[model samples]
Target chain A: MKVTILGCYSATPRTFTNPTSQVLEVRNHLFLIDCGEGTQVQLRKYKIKFSRIKHIFISHLHGDHFFGLPGLISTFRLLGRESELHIYGPKGIKEAVTLFLKLGDSWTNYPLIFHELESKDTELLFEDDSVSVSTIPLDHRVYTNGFLFKEKPAPRKLDVKATTKHNIDRSQFNNIKNGANGKTANGVEVANQKLTLDPPNPKSYAFCSDTAYNETILPLIENVDVLYHESTFLESESRLCQKTKHATAKQAAQIAHKAQVGNLILGHYSTRYKSIDLFKEEALEVFPRVALADDGKSFDI
Target chain B: MKVTILGCYSATPRTFTNPTSQVLEVRNHLFLIDCGEGTQVQLRKYKIKFSRIKHIFISHLHGDHFFGLPGLISTFRLLGRESELHIYGPKGIKEAVTLFLKLGDSWTNYPLIFHELESKDTELLFEDDSVSVSTIPLDHRVYTNGFLFKEKPAPRKLDVKATTKHNIDRSQFNNIKNGANGKTANGVEVANQKLTLDPPNPKSYAFCSDTAYNETILPLIENVDVLYHESTFLESESRLCQKTKHATAKQAAQIAHKAQVGNLILGHYSTRYKSIDLFKEEALEVFPRVALADDGKSFDI
Candidate 1:
């Protein structure tokens, strides 16, 4: 799995800093998360293929999180896209988008599917053979949900040399990989463990933003390979966090430490701060493996 | 009057090219005209004062003309702006913007007034002591209007030397500048024309975009100081212009020639053209005083 940070600042977009938005590439699918204004330009700047994005996940209805959605959809129509686009966002997303489209008289020729989410508890949102997505309800000023994407375990790898040594037929190799005992051409049984090797561990990623420090989401996101959490302020601004329902860098680090994630990526810094290095310094005090999310930065997990 | 081009290209916003949007400063008032996506960033890039903008005029309901409005308004609230902002646009604009605001639950603390228009004829939209704005109906796929900003005639300038020679008292100079005939201290009638000179001609600016070539607007914007008309295509693409309800560079110059404006500014070029100079070259054939609108360019009228 790979993650690309398109923009990672809080509040309004500035000349050098943008609001919250990112792209997650996992299991042959490109998923867009929280499209802020200027996201299409960022996508073009980063050379990301716009047509590859089939699914979009919006954490909340805040302008910083989803204002670019309508323009993106229109661009797709203008580019003559034919594939269906799926949008998963808060309950009122459909009404807002539909009204804008209706006013412009720009109904798309392609299918636009909206999956309005209203649940306040952790629940499964999407699942396929190679990937599964679940929601982690978060505490915020409004209805919000962080998404967890997990890559499903692959089939066991077949040991070609061991199978050949056992004189197993080529057709039986599929059964061996599927965790079945293989029979040799001479009708001798071969142990499945001897014929196959274990596959690599599956990877997982979790995204959380625009929320305050809450312990309820720890379990849902625990033990993930990578965790991205919004750190809107530093430790000095803890009091402001309480008023704004946002998290400080230290709080995000504590959550990462308790969840035992392999790596913690802190983002969504407030525009008031001139330096982002302070956030990394504060997070490193609580979590050893911490990274900062900057616009146009990419990470592999 | 001065005009700043924020973004002049048409259709979707790109990495290098932006959609339709501009800022017009006339008679001590800053007016935002046609805010497309990424306009806020452009405003920041150009270092334009955001708080100075008191009124916004949207040409139509097209996304390229007004998608950035909701985000801009939200940013105003985020920045703690207290001044009331007035928006004038087509009839459905109120519904579209209100729905987006409701979905985000981000009602502005400051006053937001909407002047929704549904007229097909020329009408006065805004007026103050120093300036007045009128709408010029245009032909397009949707309900559209081009704006005409006219600076009111200023008070006659008192020629200091002439006033002193006429023996006009300083106290009576104000009355003379107000276009009143002043009496000398000796009780002699001093002709206002002898003591005062005419102020520089009040300038006017007209903005027409996303419209087809129509002769009706020529009378409304006749003899304006500067006229900005959409030139979405060149003479070679005249057929495409007819089908899309847009005007070519030649068509825009023809309108300028018929209107006899001081200068013609051609913009809203189609992205298919590699060189924007083609538009200027084509427009110059019909109109001698023509300028092409480029992003970040400013013009004095």
Candidate 2:
């Protein structure tokens, strides 16, 4: 899976900093997460094929998280898109988007399917042959959900050398990979372990933002290949962070460490600090494998 | 009066080109016109003071015309703006904006007043000590209006030297400025022309956009000092322009010439062209002294 960070700053989109938006490219699918203002422009800049994004997941209704939704929808209409677009967002997203389209008298010619989410449970939102998505309940000022994307395990790899030595027939290869033991046409018992090797490990990614330090989400996101957590403040502003229901750098690192993720990505820095180095320094002290997310940066997991 | 063009291109906002947006500064009031996407960033890049903008006028509901409005409102709220903001637009504007705010659950601390407009004839929309604004009905894909900003004639310019020569009493200065015959204590009548001059010609500016080549607005914007009209196409694309309810450069110039305006500014060019010089070249054929507006360019009328 490849993760591209469109923007990472918290609060608002400014002349220099943009709000939250990212793209997760898994297999042939492009999943857009949290489209903030200027997201379409960013997509254009990054040369991302916006029409390929069939699914969009919004964490909440904050301006910084989903303000660019209407513009994106309008752009799709302007471009004459005909494919169905699925949007998974908070409960009121349908009303908001529908009102905009109604007022403008500009509705999409394509199918616009909205799945309103109001529950605070690990509900599956999307699943295909290769991947599945679920929500991770989080603590925030309003209803918000963190997304977990897991790539399903692949079929067991074939031990080519052993299979050749054992004369495993090509037609029986599928059964061997499926861990099925069967007798050969010569009445010889061919064990599946001798014919197939272990498959490559599956990868998973989790996204969390605008939330307080809640331990409940650790288990759902634990052992993921990558975890992106909002680090809106540093330890110096920890008091204000909790009061605002936002997490500090140290708190984000602590969660990542407890979850035992392979790599932790910290983002959504507040504009109060000119330098984001303090966040990296603080997070590194707690979780050594932490990296600060910069706008337009991409991570391969 | 000063008009700053924040953006002038038609259709979607691109990284290199923006959509329609302008700032009309009359006396102490800063009026914003047609906020498209990236307007806030344009405002910041142009160094326009946000707090000074007391009123915003939207010409239509097209995304290219007013997509940036909600973001600007949210930014103002985040910046702690307390003064009321007056938005004048079509009838459905209030519903669209309210729905966005409701979904975000972000209410502004400041008063947001929407003066929804629905009229087929000339209607007064704003007035102050120095200027007044009236709407000019426009023909477009949707209900649209062009704005006419006329500066109330300045207190007739005082011909101080002429007044002194005419021996006008200081107490009668006000009367002379109002084009009245000033009478001295000795019953000597001073001619008004001898004491006062014409009031700086009473400059007026009209903004006409997203409209076809219609003659109905000529009378409303007649003899204005300056006119800013949308010229989405050159003469070569006049047929397509008419189908889209947009004017060609020649058409804009024809309107300006028929209205007998002092200067004509053509804008809202389609991005298909590599340059805007063709618009000016085509417009000048019908009406000389035509200027093509560019993003971040300014015009003083």
Candidate 3:
């Protein structure tokens, strides 16, 4: 799995820094998270294929989170896209997007579906055979949700040498891989473990942003392989975090430390800061493993 | 008056090129015209002060023309703006923008007034002591209106030397500038022409975009100091121009030639083209004075 950060700055987009938007590539699916203003231009700059974005997950209704959605939707129509597009966002998102289309009198030529989310508790959002996605309810000024993506375990691998020694027929290889016992050619029963090996463990990733330091999400994201949390301020601005309902770098690190996540990625730095290194410096004091998310940075997990 | 081209390309915005958006500086007011997707970032790049822009004029409802409006408005609120903002556009704009604000629950702290336009004929939209803005109805796929900005003729310049030679009293200077006869100290009446000189001719600019090759606007824009017209295609692609409701460079020049405009600026080039010089070359074939609009390029009128 790979995660590309198109933009990670807080508030408005500037000439050099962009707002919050990222692409997570997992299980052959590219899911867009929190499309901020100017996201389509950043996508074009990064050379990410526009059509690959089949599903979009919005965290909230803030302009910095979903302002670019309308333009991206309109761009798809202009490009003559015929594939179905799905949007999972806050409850009012459907009305906000469709109203603009209605006002412009330019409806999409393809199927455009919106899944408005209003659940206060963690719930499943999307699922397929290979992967599943659920929400991590977060505490913020408005209703917001972070997504969790996990890979499903695959079938056990066939032990070719063991199967050959047991004289297992090729027809039974499928069943053997499914943890079934096989009858040898000499009429002896072979144990399933003798002909099969365990598959690799599944991996999980959690995305959290634009929230306060709430421990309620710790249970939902505990022990995740990777966790991306928003750190919009530093300790100096901790006084404003409470009123704004944003987290500081130290707070984000403390959450990662308590959750025992394997890897912690910090993003959504306020643009007022002189440098992002301060966030890393502060986060390192609490959590040893930390990565600062920057525009166009890609992380492999 | 000065005009700055923030983005003039047609269709979607690319890495190097932008869509339709410009800043017209006239009479101490920074008027924003047609805010495309990434206009706020472009405004920052161009170093145009945001607070000075009190009025925004949108030509139509196309995404490339006005999609940046919502983000810009939200940014104003984030910046803690207290001044009122006025928007002039098509009828549905008010509902479209207000709905988005309601969805996010992020209404602006300042007053937002929308002047929706539904007229198909020339109509006055704004007037002040020194300037007036009127609409130039155009033919496009949607209800579109181009804008005509005219600087009201300045009061005639007082001929200080002539007034002194004629022994005109200082109290009569105002009357002389207002085209009234001036009285000399000896009670002799002097002609206003002798005491005053004609002020520089009023300058006018007409902005026509996303429209077909229609000649009805010729009367409204005739003898203007400058004209910025959309040229979305070359003569070779004129066939597509009709279907897309856009004009070719040659066609734009034809309108400028027929209107007897002082200078013609051709823009909104299709992204398929390699260079912008072709637009100027094509337009120059029909109009003597032609300039091609490019992103970040500025022109003084």
Q: For residues B223-296, write the lDDT of model 3, one tens digit per residue.
A: 99999999999999999977889999999999999999999999999988889899999998999999989999
lDDT of each: 0.92, 0.89, 0.92
As a whole number from 0 to 100, the lDDT of residue A217 in candidate 1 is 92
Which segments of model 3 are wrong by more than 4 Å? A159-172, A182-190, B167-187
User: What is the DockQ of the complex in model 2?
Assistant: 0.64
Model 3 lDDT, residue A264, Cα: 93
lDDT of 2 by residue, A46-147 (tens): 899988999999999888898888889998998889999999999989998887777778888999999999997889999988999999888998899989
Give every collision pair in model 2: none
Report per-candidate TM-score of chain A alone.
0.97, 0.95, 0.96
Candidate 1 per-residue lDDT over residues A129-237, each given as its tens digit: 9898888898988899999999999888999999989999999877788799999877989999999888888999999998999999989989999999999999898
Task: Supply the TM-score for candidate 3.
Answer: 0.96
Residue A286 accuracy (lDDT) in model 1 = 93
TM-score, chain B, predicted structure 2: 0.93
Runs off by more than 4 Å, candidate 1: none
Could you tell me which residue pairs clash in candidate 3?
Answer: none
What fraction of the true interface contacts does model 3 reproduce?
0.66
- Candidate 1 C-alpha lDDT tens digits along B165-224: 878889987888888897888899988999888888999999999899999998898999
Q: Measured by C-alpha RMSD in angstroms, how accurate is candidate 2?
A: 2.4
Cα miss at A146, model 1 (Å)?
0.5
Write down the C-alpha DockQ for each prediction: 0.82, 0.64, 0.74
Per-model TM values vs. the true structure: 0.98, 0.94, 0.96
